[model samples]
Target chain A: MNFSHIDLLSFKSSPSPQKPLTLAPWRKLLYIKQEYPDNYVDESFLENLQKNVNFQSFDYFALCRESTVITEHISSVLIFVAVFIQLYHDHLDPHLLVSLGSAFVFLGCIIWEWCLARPAPPMHKSFLKTAAVFFLTLLGLSPILRTLTQGISSDSIWAMSVCLFITNILFFDYSSDLTYSIQFPGSVALNAAVFACVLLASRLSTNLHAFGFMSFALEWFALFPIFRRYLKRIMPTGHLIQTLLLVAITFVLFWPISRAIAVLYMIAVFSLTFICPIWLIFIQRYKNEIHGPWDEARPKVHRFRSPQR
Target chain B: MPALNICLASDFFYPNTGGVEAHLYSLSQCLLRRGHKVIIITHAYGKRTGVRYLSDGLKVYYIPGLVIYNQATLPTVFGNFPIFRYIFIREQIQVIHGHGSLSPFCHEAILHARTMGLKACFTDHSLFGFADTGSIITNKMLKFTLSDIDHVICVSHTSKENTVLRAALNPLNVSAIPNAIVGSLLKPDPTAADPEWITIVVACRLVYRKGIDLLVAIIPRICHQYPRVKFIIGGDGPRRIDLEQMRESYVLQDRVELLGAVQAADIHKLLVRGNIFLNTSLTEAFCIGIVEAACCGLLVVTTKVGGVPEVLPEHIIKFAAPEEDDLVRAVSLAIETVHVRDQRPELDPFVLHETVKRMYSWMDVAVRTERVYYSIMKVEAPPLIERLRRYYGCGQWAGKLFCILAAIDFLLYLFLEWAFPRQNIEIAPRFDHKRYVEKAVWRH
Candidate 1:
């Protein structure tokens, strides 16, 4: 049996003008026999093919506006570091720093209260009570925290803090949705930041310094993020003002330490905030998402109809 | 054409029952009738191991391996190559055809066949989404396996389009060969229809993807709308509890019957008992069950999902959107057509049977598949460099990675050939085709 002969037979059996073979319309299936071959690709083969059907084109300016979340987070981390350096060098008095942090916490609470449309008295009372208890507990635990890493080497302490801080920065919830609750850096993120603060406080020489710094770190990591989130929701202009004020303060604090390092940091922060969104828009041109009838059908049930299992 | 030695490789086969397994078995049986020597290679299922022969003289070699979820072999890429190479040599196999995209054994066999310089073909039997993590990984693996494949076969046009996009293959290389049924076994029963009571039969795995949720939601409403309607659900899965609960809550034990896990042989008997077959599957590739239902002369009311719209003529099918209200409306309309104004929708079961028989048969699938084999065999095998060139266009980094893997696989093939020289392996005895021809003639 010759293979080429079978091929020729199949070809001859196909519909021709003289034979007047009836050709079925291509319904894109091989169940029904037709005049065409098995591999015949009709003109409408890819007629339903769609590319980037649901793609949303990004605007560079809007993207930049959205990226202020990252800028705010970076500035907050930098300010914490600047405060640590000032405390470590014994340049700023511990009492003054603690008083300043307490005043700001009070002011932020009032603003947070103002942001709510229907403020509940019990929630405000419970929040104040929780804050009072947290501060008192921190003051009592200062001596223990000050000596938490007394046996560890200074170099190891520094390395541990660096690792924890990096973990905190990496896992921070940066979603810009105002309704998204601030979960206190949530899970591993919060643990890592608290661990880093404890390590840094253990490096202080006295209990008062440890207590002041520990309280300030708690306010910065835990409380300030909630305030910033609500502040952004209630007043976008105030959020922008807050970001600018933080950036200027960070630059000034770093200036006293090293002018060159501060200048490079400012340049890096500005470029990241401005240029990254543009790069994202540039790469959006290459996104190719193909959808067709071949994809799975997502069933649309209008009402919540759960079976009584 | 001279009989060519062929091997059907997949993780799914006998000891396991599914659409793909049945397809492989039926196709191999038809190919055997055409005088081709065919053997199946699959991962062992429990006590079913080593070489075994079915009643039709079709040999299956079950290699021992780890079975993962859904009877798929764990994808140890290079682990199966040595044994595969040995079997290929002993059987003198010329073509390696693989079935099912999710079967790691099939993908591995295709990859190794390419390395050994043999013609390779793949059949995709499922549709996958592009948004999910599992699909993304599976599509990447499919791309690697199909990068240098000789030909690809899909069960439907939607499946073909899906495979083409998933593997980035040339459309010309892929053929849409639908799954077929043993049409002779599914004879329509003339006494099955009742004018007063309409029975809607659904025989599929009771899973969420099979639209058991929609079935659960619509059953009570359907029963409420038409008091005489009956439902016969003939499969069981994790969703059986939900269905049973629905049956109890609605107090519909008399109208709705649940036959848990019916056998494949009984499917026709169950389908023939109903006037309509309701399939509410959210996603399907070809849906052979609906074809079987149609063969039993039942009007199919199925959701308009992947490849279903192309399955049957419009006269016998009522398409429904995969929504509760739409399905309820469609089923109600179908019931009305069957009961009240039953003129335009009424179809003669004999005509439907003839149409279905002419449209699909395993013998047709085998003939079309043999054509694919011949077309692939006519082209000379390309050089290794040329094969690498084809694989190099997979992705930016994936291209180079695939090239390296292909090169390594080629080297491994050379090593295996050197270690277990093919000339030394004993050849398996081929089945006598004259006896099969005599038996076929006697049976017919």
Candidate 2:
């Protein structure tokens, strides 16, 4: 029955009519004696070889929606770069940056509550303790952090910053929605972003600027993905709105300094959200993932109760 | 037919014991009985280096090398050429037969054998997949290794299909040859099992692939349904702890007996004591364990996975999906069959032993294998250019790389020929079966 897929092979090598008719038909069983040669390719050969039995074709809309996650992530990273650029030019006040970061953090917390998703179980007592400790630590380390990479050439700092951001994007976990805390891959991405921010923070003229930038990095890199994944899972519409809001904010942030870059960024985001998903759907027809009896069996273990005695 | 001087090469052999090792030993023994000069070439195991003679004059050459993961030597693709060339020339090996797809040593041997202009045969012992990085690499390597081999052999028909797909081989060139089960070790003892209660035996490596999770699930349920039945779980692995935990959770200390990592020789003894044998392999190419259990007169209850249903008759074995409930149902069916079969002399353990012996014997495998060998022997080994042409068809990128590797192997062969010419290398004396049988060892 499994050999039904081997139609081409069986058609070509169907038992030769020239042979003695007394020979019994070839059977798949090994226990029985057969009169064919060892390498005899029976007409039924490979009938069992299945191709893409578990194939699931993707829908254009769903694919496009999935593509938004990438778009959203890219927008957030670009927004952080725009914010950093604004800070480096001293056009933006450090206190204003910190206030803006605090307002966004408060909004993220409000959204977490609005979803009535898994109650942030660890949020109650430790949230204030964590904020206090984080504030004190940054205050203590600001001078050292501000001067850490000051001696390094600007060329090296920029190159390293680019490398780390690429690493972050490559390793970031975008699918999983179970953990409030990010998984290992996501953690690697967060660490890369944090290190990149630290390298950029060293170029700041003062401790207050370094601390404000570091705080923004924490909110964006460390916590935003977990919140984004959660929002996408429980409320897809809200996730889409958040993505658009971030893209708009990034566009506005970059528009002040470079209108050309800001417009280009919008075009990239629009295509990433709209066109790539169509391309993905178009390419879905070419997907030929072969699955057969040869694939490793995935064990389904649970509190399985046998219905029979 | 003329006797062929065959060289069976694989990373897995004699010193390291498993399915492939046992297959190599038994098949070589049968080939030796047929008057073929068979020799085994594997990497050194511990201090077991150089040449050693197995029973029936089946010579083994353990070429000393660095042992790495899973007893397989380090994969230095062209590094093995010199020694393999030396062995091939000295032994006058007409056909190079490599076993096991996972063994880089075997793959390396096949590549170099073709480079030296020798007919090569490969026997795949396990089923593999197209997914996963490890399997992808393995499939690509197999495609390269099998690009121009004379013939290929698989342990089962499903395995044949799998190998053909994995390596893109012609269906006419690949043969289905099942591994032979030694008859002497599996003689059944009907009376050894107690009439008071049925004892179910599961003899497999307690690994996830062997479906230990299914065993863990069905054991308690089966015990609840059949109060008198006991279980004997043989073999050990990382999943052993899971089984132990299951037994503890169900408080089945009295009913379940864990015979951890039973020696291969003792497994048959364990099989004889059980009225039913349960196999829960998730994906199996060929299950020799079930046949052995049936030979010992145990009614077989196993998952209907890759090549398993083709192994035994419907009356002797019951099939189940890899799921828990179905496995439990199969066990129940098997238990009932065993109960009814107690009265019939035809289904007796002794009778089953004779039936299995007739159905699957090493002699049968050897005869079929000999036929394959003889067929391949007449074909001329292709020149390096023709060989490179075959490798180039493997893939756009991989083909060129394979061609380069084949050319390098050709250069290495020339260097070895110049460094250690055939005239300089002493040809080892052929094993005389007649003289060996006449003479007896008396070191004492």
Candidate 3:
């Protein structure tokens, strides 16, 4: 809103007993005891005010494209759950799932080594070293993990998994910036996904099922997010294709279980990617940022360079 | 004009010293001097509870209430209405003047006063931005409270604009009445300044908003530039360590003195000791610090943020953007001015003090505030239905909510009147200012 209306409204509201020209011109200074009434506002009122100083206007297509990160994250999460459901029903072999996940991780590492804008830093522990240690630890923990939730009902297990997954999706860092270090909320999201994986692992029948499922869950939850963020930055087209592939996989896998669920999933993915961005852009006109002298000044500290010459 | 019974409501008053507290006390005194009955209403500060009298027979009602934070009373919309109504009826207060926009007690008082059909005028002590959760909430509350206000007073023109925008008030109702300091208290000491050292006094709570960060950034560069210059930093807060660290790292301990947590009474002495008073506030409504410093005959170097520019004349004060390099440059210019002034024999602290005294006197503020009081009294009080309509226009959701609150406040007002019954409450005897002064004060 133009603040000039305030000057006019305030002037119009008052009972102007004398002509404004009859008095000395109004100055903004408080030091001067002017002849005019205290409330008498002139043209100079709110002259220094500036609105929408740092506002960013968004485009509909750009917003829709940007929203793909959310759709991609949701789709990938649903695909993992579908795979979990397949393993739960004994439709997918645990050994085959583990081998496929390992092969994918190996290919992702090759791409990470070659295609990164800033090449993946020299690994503190090489992927193989950490994977071996983790594999050995999981091998020992499999028997204990399989029997962990045997006493609990399956309904409660399903409910708890859904809750943990929701928590993960809500806190997940969707930003694709490599410079953005993991904050506490992002860490919470990562941990929630891992915890959900461990919970679902308890429901599996055999030790190999638990171990193999747990390994795929780790590969999907932990490492995949980092990879997806990199995919968007390094290869935007590949990222879009990857998102479409995840949605299709979720749909195809869920269709065998229930056709209604597959159709619902497709609609959710479509609206999240398409309709939500349009709604966001629709509300962008409501953005009103008022900036003037009242804002806290960001101190510009200049670095003192000592004279060496 | 007949003497008006004015109740000044704010959570800030004596026992907790600050700008708002000082404004209340002195403004009350000046109002009393003008033959108006001025009483301050504030929350209790420790054992200083109940009604107490200060100099000039200005009565302060220390209304006991829970202080939520920074001495602001908990915003119970209708909780304080009973006692407020009882006080209003008993004292026969015709005008309710509230101070400090941040003070919830003041806001509540204004709300209840409108319910009681008394003319309410609010004075905004600070400027607020339209960002941040705290500001957004405060601005909304201000809007609800000031929607039906009789008049509004801001401490500066910049502050007036801020209030008009924040509360959506008509500019004609919101006047720019700058806060005034007690001139007799801040007598400049010509002998206090050191001849050899160019002492620059820095006084404020060492917080980020006060631009203590800028002070920390610029001090070393300023010291490095001038060999004879030194700093006397006063007041303490969370950012005090940064200032200490800056001093220690630069190893200019001898050049810089950190006088931690200086009281209000000692600010004049601190200002007098330096040739320049340096203020680096990020946002100020109308900084009385620069006024007090200018009164002490010190060259004022302040950032050109908020109303700092409007407070002092250009010759006495130098303004800079709230940046490290600009502030350092401003200080350099102030140091140069001080040096040039040192060569002349025409430097007189009394003349500077007199100029400030003329520019800002509590009597002038009181007279202007009196004019506001008189003007508001002329305004017809809006009925409850009309008032609800005013609140309904405050916002979409908040407007409806404000209307509900106002309706409930009216109901509370009805309950208080029936419960306490104004007839049962004995009217407090009005203090005869003239008779008391002539008999007790002059007789001694």
Candidate 4:
């Protein structure tokens, strides 16, 4: 036996034979309206879509596939060049840079400890024990790191350092999690910087200079990401200023050819961000989600063996 | 009736044992029973290479290639094009039917077949999510592959909806064709021929998605209420550890048996041992297991998630929410219903036979598939325009793209004929005469 149902639509006004138009509540949202399988293109629909005063032409910018890799490499290259300039010019003492960086790292650590302490009153001793162990590990690792790459060449070391730094940036998850922080990037960045310093440490004339450079890298890469992330979350304006200041500082340090290249890179990066989102929106127009009774039904398992700990 | 040449393409083939493999096998046999020439194309498995026959005139070409993660061949679009072209031409393939979404092999087969000027049909057997990144990428890939296809076949109505949305295909181009079970494989176990002890069968990979977590929770409670009831759990996965923990905690050691990955040949025997076939899965499309269980003359107690409710009538199967408590209650009710009666209720054996006959059959699938092939082969604009009208409703952007792709594909077909003329290729003669005739008689 075949089972079928007939559907009837009740309207307040009588339908006309020619050029009859029946309009429902018109809204831009796609999901809410009664949908028909056969209604692909309504005759008056395009005309009404075109009539909207606010409708504007969408820009389709081409995305350079290698843009992300180029931007990351250029910025890191610029930062290293700036550090080298400071060291050669002797305007900023290597020892002094190292000391200041270490001080900042210590302060950041103290603040992190303070925040974590507030969550659990009885876990203060456990937190202190962890903090103590962390400090000790850093202290012990520094000496070993100083002599770690002594066997390797200066150029090879620099090359390795650059690769590791890039790897750290690429692998780091950039999802907008609740605990968004500069510190997250900063720590990995610092780790990469310290490895670079260790390679350059062998180039230093004295042990103290090597120690200073290593400390400087530790401070810059490790603590900076956390601070950056915290600042972005706590103060948006401050984060924007910091980003602008870094860009401006990078431009000034690079100068001449590098300066122009930096500006072009920034424009390219901004264009890339906008281009991707727009492309995604354009692609969304192709989203023909076909749902019916044929797809696998997700079972609703209600048995909770352990409802609570 | 003239026998039609049918080519079956899937990411999965023989030497592999799963629903898709069984589906391909049963379908080929069924189509052969209707006097259709069936050939299967699958990525080569270890030591299983070149063309081989599986019993009845059904030929399988185990095309040698790399098996990527989980038996799915490494998908290099256009890489499999040449070999596939050779196979299609050699076999005089009229209809190209691909199975499974995850198989790039299946997707590529459909695309190349379209480009080679053959009618292509895709059968989707699984459901996918739109929320995840992996699913998003897969969906986009599906759209690209499905852009120029003639028709799509899904196992259930829900699967049709999913494929339409996932690939952005026209709804009418898709059809709900549920999978079928071989009646001989499923029969109630004769050994545990007792009316007192109720045996509940749970067979599936013990995974999180399978709702094995809910199974672990409910089994103890079920065993508690009914002392005589015993559980036979089949298949194994990571969540088996948790099930073991639950088993130990509840101390229902002797009541439940973990068979652990029973072979395909043994599934029927394992299923027969149980009075109630329990499916605790949280989601499904058209569950072949439930149908097979029903075929075995066992009452089905399954969670009403996905397309399980639509698979069978309410009288034959008991429904429950995907939750643990509800499943426990539902199973209890099924057991209670079974006990109150002196003997098992007279379940219409014809229900399974009629359902399998009406909704499934390789000949029906092949005939419908052949129509799509004929439509693609026709050069005239009128029929092509009608097919385009069906595709033009997928989406605003997709409709235009699909139309353009289909038109371009048609042009490509004309070009390929000029480049590689069909007159140059030799067609192989039919495999057998007496057996083919005998098989057709057997089916009716």
Question: What would the per-residue lDDT of candidate 3 be over residues B119-197, giving only the tens digit for each residue?
Answer: 9989998988898999999999999989988888999988998999999987877788899988888888989999899
**Which regions of candidate 3 deviate over 4 angstroms?**
A1-22, A106-120, A125-127, A146-151, A179-181, A303-309, B343-348, B440-444
TM-score of 1: 0.89
Task: Score residue A212 of candidate 3 by CA lDDT.
Answer: 91
**What's the CA RMSD for each of the models?**
4.0, 4.1, 3.7, 10.1
- Best to worst by DockQ, what's the order? 3, 2, 1, 4
TM-score of each: 0.89, 0.93, 0.92, 0.68
**DockQ for all models, in order?**
0.33, 0.41, 0.45, 0.13
Q: What ranking emerges by TM-score with the best candidate at the front? A: 2, 3, 1, 4
Model 2, B1-444: lDDT tens digits are 788899999999876768898899999999997888999999988889999988888899999878877787888998878889889989999999999998989999898888888888999989888888999999999999999798899988989999999998888788888877988878888778777889999998888889988898889989999998999998988999998988887889999999898877788779888998999999999988998888887788888888898898987788988888788888988777776786878777788888888889888888888877877776776777778888999999999999898888888888888888779999988889867766856522
Residue A33's lDDT within candidate 3 is 70
Better of 1 and 4 by TM-score: 1
For model 1, what is the alpha-carbon lDDT of residue B384? 96
lDDT score of residue A17 within candidate 2: 55
Over B1-444, each residue of candidate 4 has an lDDT whose tens digit, in order, gives 466788999879777777889889988887776667889999888888888888787888888778887688888765776678878998999788899998888987887786666777788888786656878777876887776676677776656667766786656566556677666446445465355688899888888768887787788778888999989898988888987887788777887888898898988888778788899877787788887777766778998866677677777789988777788889999889767544544554445434433434445444444444444444322356655664465568877876776666556556667787777777777788456557676654
What C-alpha lDDT, on a 0 to 100 scale, does residue B272 get in candidate 4?
A: 73
- TM-score top scorer: 2
Q: Where is model 2 more than 4 Å wrong at Cα?
A: A1-19, A114-126, A303-309, B194-196, B440-444
Point out the higher-scoring one by TM-score: 2 or 3: 2
* lDDT to native, each model: 0.84, 0.84, 0.85, 0.66
